[model samples]
Target chain A: MVPDDDTQTADERWLCAVLQRQGLEVEPARLAELARAQALLARYTEFLRQASPVSVRHLGQPHDA
Target chain B: MMPEADGDTPGLAQAARALRAGSLSSLELTRHCLARIAELDPGLNAFVTLTEERALAAARQADEELRAGHRRGPLHGIPLGLKDVIDLAGVPTSGQSSQLHGHVPMRNAAAVDRLEQAGAVLMGKLTTHEFAFGPPRWGPPGPPARNPWHAAHFAGGSSSGAAVAVASGMLLGALGSDSAGSVRSPAALCGVAGFKPTRARIDLRGSLPLAPSLDCLGPLARSVEDCALLYRALAQPGEDFWRADELPWGEIRGLKIGVVRSFLDERSGTSAPTRTAIGDAIATFEALGCEVRDVSLPAPWEWNAAGMVILLGEAFAYHEHWLRSRPQHYGAGLRDALLLGATLSAADYCRAQEHRQALSSNLDALLEDVDLLLCPIQASAAPPLDQLTTWGFLEKPSYGIAFNLSDNPALSVCCGFGPQGLPLALQLVGRRNDEITPLRAGHAYEQACEWHRRRPPL
Candidate 1:
C-alpha cells in the first residue's frame, strides 16, 4: 500500500505532465509526486472503464435528504 | 458544580447530571462548547460548519422549558456534532465532495431528527473523507482533519472529524457512519470509544450512502457509557434487538470468549507494543473468570474481497453520473476509488452479495458457543501524516469490517498505548442484534482498567 521509491518518482513525473498540460508554469521537482498520483488515477479510471457496469442500485434516489 | 479544568468543561455524564440538577443552564453549556470549538477547531479542523445562531437559539429554548418544569432527558440541551454525510435542515450535506458543495437539504436525516427530538442541540457539521471512500489528501476544498494527539498524525477516516471533535473535547459526542472501519478506525487512533451497531438497529433513511448494504450510523464518544446513551436515543422503537442497560451483567461472569489468534498475530507491521497490549487484555479477561478459547473462521481475505466488491459496486452506482460528468472536481484519491467502483459488473456485485450471505452464516456458526469474539482494532498505532495513502483501507483485515459484512455489532475501546504514546485498541464483537453483550463487556473492562481515564496530552 505504501508507494515505493521508483513508483513515487513516476507519480511525481505524472503530476508534472498534468501541470504542463494545464498550461500552469511549474517546477518539475516541485510537482513530481503529484504527477505520479495523476497517472495512478488514470490507471484506475481505465480499470473502471473495462471492469464496471452501466448501472447498479438506488440509482434514482436522492442520496441527501 | 465541579470547577472546570479550563472553565465549566465537563465530561458527557457530568454535563447531563448538572443539567438535570439545574446547576448548569443549557445556554451556559452551549456557549462553553461554542467557545471551545472556536478556540480548538482551527488547529484540529474538526468542524466544517458551525451553527452558532441555531444552536444558541435552541439552547435558550431548552433553558426556558427547563425553567417552566418541562424537561426532555440526558441529551436535552447537550451540544453534539453531526458528521457531514448526515442531513440537517437548511444545511449543505456535501458528503465531503466538491461536486455537491452547494447542495442543501430541506429536512434532517432520520437519525438527526431523532436526536433533535430528544433535545440535543446541533453544534455543527464535522468533516468526512471524499464521499466516505478515500483517504485524506491535504489540498481539498478544505484541509484534512488532524489528530488532536499529534497534529502530524492522521485521525483515521472517513469519520475523521467526528473522532477529532469528540477527542479534543470540542463536542461531547458526535455521530459517525461506518462502511468499512470509518467509525472504529478513527476512534481507535484518536483514543476514544466507537460503536458500530447492528446494521438494521438504526434506520439509514436520510444519510448519504457509501455502500447501502454495509453503511451504518453510530456514535463516537469519550466512554462506553456515552456511546450506550447515544445508542438509546438513536435506536428505533421496535428495531433494536439488544439493550445494554437491560442486560444482566452477572450472566457474563463465566461466559466463553473466542480468541481469533491467527487474525491478530499473523499480520506483519504489527508493533511489539500493540501485541503486548492485546496479550494483557486477554489475560485480564481470563483473570475475570471468563473462559478463553481459540477459534478459527473463514480466511480474513475472503471477507475483505467480498466487502470490496459490494462496496465498490454500490458506491459506483451512486457516483457514475458525477464520474462521467464532473470527475475533475473530486480529489485524486476519491477519483481513483470511484473508478474502481465503476469497474465492478453486475455479476461481480451479485456474486459478492451471495458470498455475503454465506459469510454471515459462517460467522453465526462460529459464534454459536462463544459469547464474544476479540481482536486488535488496527495493525499498528497511528501512522505519520505524510505516509497516509489511498490503499490504506485495503492493506489489512480491518478487525471491524467482517462484522459489518455480517451486519453484527462491534465496539472498539482503548486497550493501551504503544511505545510512541499513540493509542491501541481492542475490538469486541457480539452476535447480530445482540449489541448489549459487547457494550457490557467493554463497560466492565473500562471500570477495571485505566485506559479510558487517560486523555491525549494535547
Candidate 2:
C-alpha cells in the first residue's frame, strides 16, 4: 500500500485496519482522531496498572474483576 | 380570553393552582406553550417534534377531568417535553442519531407512561446529542439547542433542549436522562434546576441507554420544588419520595454543609466567575446558619476516569453491532468515541468495574461526615457552542459523573450569575438514596435567593 502520511502509530493504524476489515467504516481524518484516543487509552492503561494507595482496601471485596 | 403573550411562564405549582381555581384552562396553557414554541423555538430550537394535536387533546382531557373533580396531582395539565432518548408511543425515539431517526417505538417507556398518567401534557420531543452523548451538533438528526440566557452560547447536553425549553418557557418542565451529567449540566448552564435521583431507585425500562450502569432519567424545571414533584411522581416504591412543597426549608439553620474546596482551588479548571459564585453561595450558607466546612475526597478525576471506562464498556456492548454495520450514520465525535471503546478489553472493562466499586465505597464513606456535599456544576458558565470539539465530551472530568458512579442523588440549581450574565450553579450531592436532604438544601437555597426566579431573556 502507499506510505501512510498521518500520525497514527503502527498499532493504532493496524487496529483501524482490523476494524475496517470487520466492516466498520471510518473516514481518513478519523484515523488521527482514533490515534489520539489510543494515546489516552495508553495513559489509562498505565494509570490502572499502578496500585492505588487505597487498593489494599479492595482485598476480598467480591468484585467481578 | 387571555392574551397570547403572558410574558413569563408560571411555575408548575402556581399553574396548578390557577387550573384548580377555574382561572386557567389546561387548553389555554397548552395553547400558550404552542404559541411560545412557534414564536421562539426558531432561535432556541428546543423541540424536535411538536405534538400539537396530542398536546391539545391531553389538555382538553385534563380540563374535563378537573371539571369532573378527578384531579391527579400538582403536575396536572402541565406542558412538558421529553428528551428524544425517551420512547414516546408512535414517535421516533431518535436519541438524536441518524440511524435511529426512523426507529419509532410502539409503546411508551415506563417513565413516560407514569408522567402521562399524572396529567402531564406532552408538548413534544427535545433534541439530544447523538445517542445521548452530545452538545447538540455532532452530525445529529436535529439542530443544536441554543441557550436562552445567551443566544450565542452553549446550552450544555445531552439534555440541552430540555433545559432550553424550560428556561425559555416553551415548556414548564422536561425529562432529561443522565449518564454522566446529561441532565444536570444543561440545567446548571441554562439556569434551571436539574435533578438526578439515585439511578437504581427509578425505572429505566423503555428509555435508551448510553451506559446501563450509570443511566438515569430525571427532570429539569424552574425550581427545586418543581423537580421534587416530578421526582416523587416518577420514583418506584421505597424510593423515599417526599413532597418538596412540604420540605422543612427552616432546616437550613443547623445542617452541616461540606464544601468541596479542592474542586474550586487554584488550577482546578473552575473559572473565576464560577469560583466567585461558589464563594458567594458558601457565604450565603453560613449566613443562613448552616455550618460549612472543607471536605475532601479522592481527586474527582479518578472518579471521572473510572466512570468513563464503565460507560464506554457498557455503551460499546450496546452499540457494537451498529459500530460494525452502520458506523457512517454516527457523528464523527460519537463515532470516534465508540471506536475507541473497541480498544477496551474485557480485562479493562472488568478492572474498571472494580475501580467503580472502590469509587462508590469511597464516596459513601466521604459523605458520612456531611449532611450534603457542595460542588461546582461546571468549570465555567456555558461557553459558545462553536468551541466544542468532536471529542470534547471525553476530555474533561464531570463533577456530576462522580455522583452517578456512586449511585447518589444530585441536584443542580443556579447559584448566581457571572459577570457576562451567564448562569453559574452548584451540585448538591447526598448519601446514596438520600434524596430528601439534598432537595431540602436545594429548596432552602432556592428560597433564600432569587436565582431560580430569573429566567433567560429569550
Each model's backbone clash number: 11, 0
Candidate 2, residues B1-458: lDDT per residue as tens digits?
A: 34224467878777877887778889989998898999999888888888999999999999999999988887788899999999899988888888886898999999999899899999999978878884456344777889999989999988999999999988889999999999999999999999999887668899998999899999999998888888877877573554523543456788888888767765567888898889988988898899899988766677667777788878888999988777778877787777777777776777677777887886677788788999897899998888876656566657888888888999998999988899999999988888888888899888888799986766
iRMS (Å) per candidate: 9.2, 2.5
lDDT score for residue B97 of model 2: 81
Candidate 1: list runs displaced more than 4 Å: A1-65, B2-8, B239-251
Residue B123 in model 1: shift from native, Å? 0.4
lDDT of each candidate versus the true structure: 0.77, 0.82
User: Lowest lDDT 10-mer window, candidate 2 chain B?
Assistant: B239-248
List the candidates' TM-scores in order.
0.85, 0.94
Which number leads on TM-score?
Answer: 2
Candidates in order: C-alpha RMSD to true structure: 7.5, 2.9
